[model samples]
Target chain A: MRSDFVRREVATGLRRNVTMTVAMVLTTAISLALLGTGMLAVRTIDSTESLYADRLEIQVALTQDVSAADQDCSQPICSGLKKTLENSPLVESVTFESQQEAYTRFQQLFAGQSIADVARPQSLPATLRVKLADQQTGADAVRQAMNGQVGVRTIIDQRDVVGKLFDFLGGVRNVTFALALVQAVAALLLISNTVQVSAYTRRVEVGVMRLVGATRWYTQLPFLIEAVLTGVVGAVLAGVGLVVAKFAFIDDLLAGIAQNGVIPPITIYDVLETSIWLLPIGAAIAGVTGYVTLRLYVKV
Target chain B: MVAMATVATHEGSSLPLTLGDGRGGIRERSPRRAEGAGRTRVAGAAPGTVPTVIRLERVTKMYKTSTRPALDRVSVSVDKGEFVFLIGPSGSGKSTFLRLLLREDVPTRGRITVADLDVAKLPRRRVPRLRQRIGVVFQDFRLLPNRTVGGNVAFALEVIGKPQATIARVVPEVLELVGLEGKADRMPHELSGGEQQRVAIARAFVNRPLVLLADEPTGNLDPDTSQDIMLLLERINRTGTTVVMATHDHSIVDSMRRRVVELDLGQVVRDESRGVYGVGR
Candidate 1:
């Protein structure tokens, strides 16, 4: 009930076992940092998926006859396919690219590549770029509508390539979580061990206190507070570590992909948001571990 | 069964001899009265006479590891402000008797009443409150090595949430009473064995408890040092605190000539007023 006494006891307990206290703090910090990184990776993956989802579209390539014959999609065969696609309920909008325009875009897509030299205007086929209202079922509906029609060649779903990128990011998240779990287990052992050692070192004083009318809870409270204090300090260290990692590690590692807008950047805000959660999570783990250790191994 | 007959004869014949205060009638009814709710009331005492502060009725303790009970059907009482000695061999349950009074261990059977609180019936959460009314000292002194003498004494009040003002005011008073006023700033290791015991006594007595239970207070000290400590305890006993001490030291008990209860094999063999150690054995 006395704050000063509790504070004094906590300070003494932590100071008496300085090495164990430091070990506990460092372990908790590393584990919580890994957990924060895993959470941020998940956020990044979600944002990247939404960013590409807005621009996702299906490409419909026409036959070579259509490419050679149609100049501006003014011919009946070319214009008819564009009109049908635009009229479908699944299609949000349709734009046609002639062979010459497709060739220009292809050169821009691979400007510095050796393959650009082999492509001519007649080599690239005329195509219709179709934006869908819904990504999940619209691509199938568009492919079914144009199946085996005259002047139609193939339908390309862009999501197939983008899905691979997401899979890689998901893998990163899973790996981070798995590593975090392992580190968390290490941190748990350290916390419990520290509590036990601290309790053991102070057994004489605690026994005296109990004999002199101090409650069991009163004697054990200092140990609990010491654990929680270490946990909170570790959380603060983990938060700082996350912010530094964003700039020092994550940004540099993700530079190329983030520049191309293939994945969202790991911002300071994202790291901070994830870091805020580590405080409570760290405290809960330390508190529960302290309580259980005392109950099971140490009487006081 | 032989011990039970010995106990009956001892109670019937020796009970009257020990009633030195002329309260023999009330003393005779105590075992029956302890069984009921009237244990706290001194039925026929003079207007200002002290009431019974501790009572044990047919108390028995059986530790599972051993067939012999640690204590067997032990019955005794001590009045307020009285100094009583529990003398026995090492394994004759002297320490167990003090431990049961402190509620550190429970008797397997029978009732113990200390400061009007039934030991068995007290709730676990309320045990601390019961202990607050009693002070305990051990042979080892059990002082916190890291804390100063003042800090160790103040610790007793601090853990119970006493304010800083009260701790500052009362710690020095207790230290002075125990004759360690100037040694408050010294650590436990800095003091001699006798002085260290004084610090432990200061800590225990700082709370002004109703009863003081000492388990071999002089077990670790020299003869001269033990005598000094006994004098200090006697001084404290004069302040109206009941003192129950268990000891293996015969000289101190024989010299003090206080009421002595002798135990042998977990049974009370003799309880005498102004008794000496090993008087008839």
Candidate 2:
């Protein structure tokens, strides 16, 4: 029939079923909030790993010296060799270390310990520190290229720590996605059930409209609009809830981490970006649920 | 005025002439000429002013049931602007005959047309539109209980998607015609039986239908109220709406002295002009 009549009918339906409508909105909002929080958590893990990867460095350690014929060498010999290696194509920079320098670094690391009583300094190995283009490729290549160098015993790549950190973050991301999916499914069930009941309650009016030559679209349009409204409100609530949680828990935890110099802090921009995308996703979920449920249960 | 007078005529037999009231008399004259010579009227002579708007041609309705048809090869036609009565006992298919005009039940054998719309093979979607052209008053009044008298009347136009302004304008006029102007805001349950039927009549006539077919319209009313409804229907018929009333109310039919088509066992037993309810009455 007329658009004005359809609008009036929809308004009447909403007014008559106010309690159910609010319940539907609240359930949708809660479920979407859970989903948004999970998504933001995954995003935080990704950003943290990216920041860690960008700043982290790989350090290579050279073992005890050997002579060219017998591979034996002094700290002076290794230092001169380190300078020669620094000029190579693969190496970005190289710093030489003597036994005395190693002893001084150990004393700084364990400051209050009686190092003279517990240990002697004459047994330390002098080495060259090497920085490469990248930890995985350039540092590995450097270690391989230096395998047969004179007075070199072994090379140690420090990228093992970076590998372990990435593995942890990957596990976190997978768990986060799984939780998000569960929340989304729950939202779908709740919203679809609510819409189905709404259609059922209005079934007599639907029947009369059908008899009066109303097409299927006209009969279902109001419910579809209601579903859209629910979706929009739910999504906004979800995004807001995430913003609050991000500030309450995540920011405080990151702040504590930054004080200890363990890591830099996360930002609200990251959370906002992730949560904003959830709005459309929420609306889509509501629309699909409304369309499918009405198709199956209500006909014009 | 009809009086019983016996006189000798040219056929060497005595004929009876009953003369009585101006509204109640029997006049039968047999043609002296040959049959079928003047039976069919020539074209362009105003189409013989009978008050029947519906015509059925060898109509037969055979449902998916037993051996016999529901309406077996029935051929009857009604003229325009006439208050015709269809009288029958139970199982005589009086309801079926009423349904045929509304196209609720289509004939299986031949064509049936109402208001010049060939209703025999009319499409299903056009049924409601066709119904809008014919006002049907049911015995139950069939008023929506939730609606006011005015709302019920406006619903007839509303279903056909008439604009609100038109509905607002026409509903009050129809309600005034039905003498229910003061009861426009009252629900159906709040009105008396006569008033409720008037509301229904107003609903049916709001769009000025071509024919008014009432299936036992006064069945639920008292005798006085039934006469009032009949009077309303007669008034509507005076304005050129062909009115067909199906009823078993002997008193109402006997008093009207209108054209009566009497049916017995799904077949017309008598087709009499100005027929009475019973010979004794």
Measured by TM-score, the strongest candidate is 1
Q: DockQ of every model listed?
A: 0.69, 0.11
User: Which parts of model 1 have CA positions greater than 4 angstroms off?
Assistant: A63-88, A143-152, B1-52, B55-69, B72-79, B106-112, B116-124, B261-275
Fraction of the true interface contacts (Cα pairs closer than 8 Å across chains) found in each model: 0.81, 0.06
Question: Best lDDT goes to which candidate?
Answer: 1
How many clashes in each structure?
Answer: 0, 17
Per-residue lDDT over B47-138 for candidate 2, one digit per residue giving the tens place of the 0 to 100 score: 34333368777676777875666665566676555567888787677888877877767777777888768887788666665676788787
Q: State every prediction's TM-score relative to the real structure.
A: 0.85, 0.58
Q: What TM-score does candidate 1 reach? A: 0.85
Chain B TM for prediction 1:
0.85
